[model samples]
Structures are given as C-alpha cells and as structure tokens.
Target: MFESIKRDLSFIQGLLEGDVNHQHHVEYRGLSRLVDVVDLLVESVEQLERRLSELEEYVETIDEDLNELELLCYDDDEEDDEWDHEIEVTCPECGEDVTIDEDDLDDENVELLCPKCHTVLDLEEIDEEDVETVISED
Candidate 1:
C-alpha cells in the first residue's frame, strides 16, 4: 500500500518539476511552490509509514510476551490438582499417624493437634515428600 502511494508521489513530483520550468512566469511560480510542498508531503508520509511499521512490530512483541506471562501465571492447575483432599502426617509427640483435611488448613501457620493423644504438630516442619508418600500410599 505504501509502495503504491510512493510511486504515485514520484510521478506527481516529476510532473510538477516539468511544469515549474514552463515559460508562463506567474503559472511557473505557483507550480514551483506546489512542487516544493509535494516533496515535503511525500517525505512526511514515508517517515510516518516507517514509524507505523515499527509500532506494529512492537505491539506483536508485547502480545507474545503477554501470552507467555499468562501461561506462567495460570498453567499449574494440573500439578495442583494431583494432591487429594486429605493429608496424612505422623504426630511427633504421640508418634501416632493422623489424617487431616486440606480444606481445614488456614492461611497462617497453625497447629495440627493429634486426635489420638492431643499432641501439637507443626505441619511445616514435616517434609512435604514424606506427607506426599503417605498420602499416595493410602
């Protein structure tokens, strides 16, 4: 599209250049001014086309980056879904195994009181792999 416009502008510049040198003094002056204006307009349009192309490439890059960011942010549902509702842990105080529901867990660190002997258990202190092993075995 831009190439077509540039070709048309070049044709007009050639015609104006010829008309500017004609013998009619008054008409020649008007044609000369028109030629200068046309040249400036063509140069401005070319610059605009260049800038628009750059902007298009920039927008495409941003779109790709946003797609990657979306995958990183929300693509872990499968991994998260592997864990079951209940997590089994061994109480350190009473040495009794206990099953706790994941839904009952709070946001902050809290005690997992064992029902067998009322032993206070710190869930974070237990290795996650051990808990996963027990849960998976069950």
Candidate 2:
C-alpha cells in the first residue's frame, strides 16, 4: 500500500516538475508541500513498523525464558519430593525431637546437629529399628 502511494506521489512530482508554466503557481507549491508531508508520514510509519517487529521478537525471547524458569521451578519441586521420607529421632543431648531428611542419612560425611541445643548428634548411635520413617501428608 505504501509502495503504491509512493509511486503515485513520484508520478505527481514528475508531472509538476515537467510543467514549467505552473512552477510559480500557489496550487503547485501547495501540492509540493503536501507531498513532502506525506513522505515524512510514510517514513514515520515504516520506522514504527520496524520498532513493532523488534518488540515482538523481544517478547518472544522473554516467553522462552519464562518457560525455562517454570521448568526449573517444577524440577525443584520434584527434587523436594525425593526427601519427603523424614527420619524423626530424639536428640540424646537435649531430648528434643530432631527431624532429618532420608537422603541426608545416606551421606556418611553429613553431620546431624540438634537444632534446640546445637549439639552434634551421632548418626551411628541411632538404631535402624528405632529410626522411624515418617511420610509427610503434603
């Protein structure tokens, strides 16, 4: 549409320039001004179209990032589920009931501390038969 308008404007300009008798006429000057204004308007519209295209591309990139972030968040939730089987034991130092994730027990280097008294709890001292695996409701 813009190309067609530009072509028509170019034709008009060619005709105006060719007519030497109407070079100093008020109507010719007025038409010349109108053409200049229309040219500027067309350039402005083209610039706006380019900017809109760039904005669309930027939005698409943001959408992809959001999808990746959502997946990472979802995977984190699933990872949390793996440690749902908690081992509850009474801390011998403070007699406080200390809860531990089941996965942490597999790591021999992991030090278990009683939260109430900050006393180091021996993982080896806790009997396997006494260690209760509590399945959380949620």
Candidate 3:
C-alpha cells in the first residue's frame, strides 16, 4: 500500500515538473506542498511500524522468560507435598502461637524465632507430646 502511494506521488511530481507553463500558478504550488506533506506522513508511518515490531519482539521475549520462571518456582513434587504438614507450637518466651513447617522439624539444629517477640525458640526444648500437628482442610 505504501509502495503504491509512493509510486502515485512520484508520477504526480513528474507531471508537475514537466508542465513548466504552470510552475508559477497557485494550484500547482498547492499540489506541490500537498505532495511533500503526504511524503512526510508516509515516512512517519513506516518509522512507527518499525518501532511497533521491535516492541512486539521484546514483549514476546519477556513472556517466554516468565513461563520459564513459573515452571521453576511453581513445579509440584512429592518433596513439596511433605512440607504441607505443619506443627503448631507456642513460643516459650512470649507464649505466642508459632507455626513451623514439618520439614523444618526434621532438622534438629534448626532454630525458630517468635514473630511477636524476637526470641530464639529451641525445638528440642519443646516435647513431641506437647506439640500439636496442624492439618489443613485443603
């Protein structure tokens, strides 16, 4: 479409230049100015089209990266299923209820902190009989 318009404009410009008798006429000058304006508009549209194509390519790359990150972050496994079980224990320092992941309980050296008060909670100090298992309905 742009090529056709450019060809037609070129033909009109050739005709205007060939007709030397009407070079100084008002209508000839008007047509000449109109052609220049249309030429500028066509060039602007071509530039905009190029920029839009570049933006589309950039967006596509970002979308692919996001898909890769989602797969890495949200992939489901049996190991992750074990983490679903939680243990509820009260913080001895502040008596605040603290929820700990079951996976963390397996590591005897893991230290817990109370959210309400910054006190170190020793898992070994809390007896297994006193700790309650929290089961999620989900």
List, in order, the clash count of every candidate structure.
Answer: 0, 0, 0
lDDT of 1 by residue, 37-135 (tens): 766787898899899999999999999999998888767865566765677777777768788776645535566788989977776677675463334
Off by over 4 Å in 1: 1-24, 77-138
Per-model lDDT: 0.72, 0.87, 0.87
List model 3 lDDT by residue over 8-121, tens digit each: 989999999999999999999999999999999998998899999999999999999999988877775544754578899888777898988878977988889999997998
Ranking of all predicted structures according to TM-score, beginning with the best and ending with the worst: 3, 2, 1
The TM-score of predicted model 2 comes to: 0.56
**For residue 12, what is the lDDT in candidate 2?**
85
Clashing pairs in 1: none
How many clashing residue pairs, candidate 3? 0
- Alpha-carbon TM-score of each model against the true structure: 0.45, 0.56, 0.65
C-alpha positional error of residue 92 in candidate 1 after TM-score superposition, expressed in Å: 30
lDDT of 2 by residue, 1-138 (tens): 778978988998888889999889999999988988988898899889999999999999999999999999989998887557889988877788888888887789999988999999888788875577888855
Question: Candidate 1: lDDT of 3?
Answer: 71
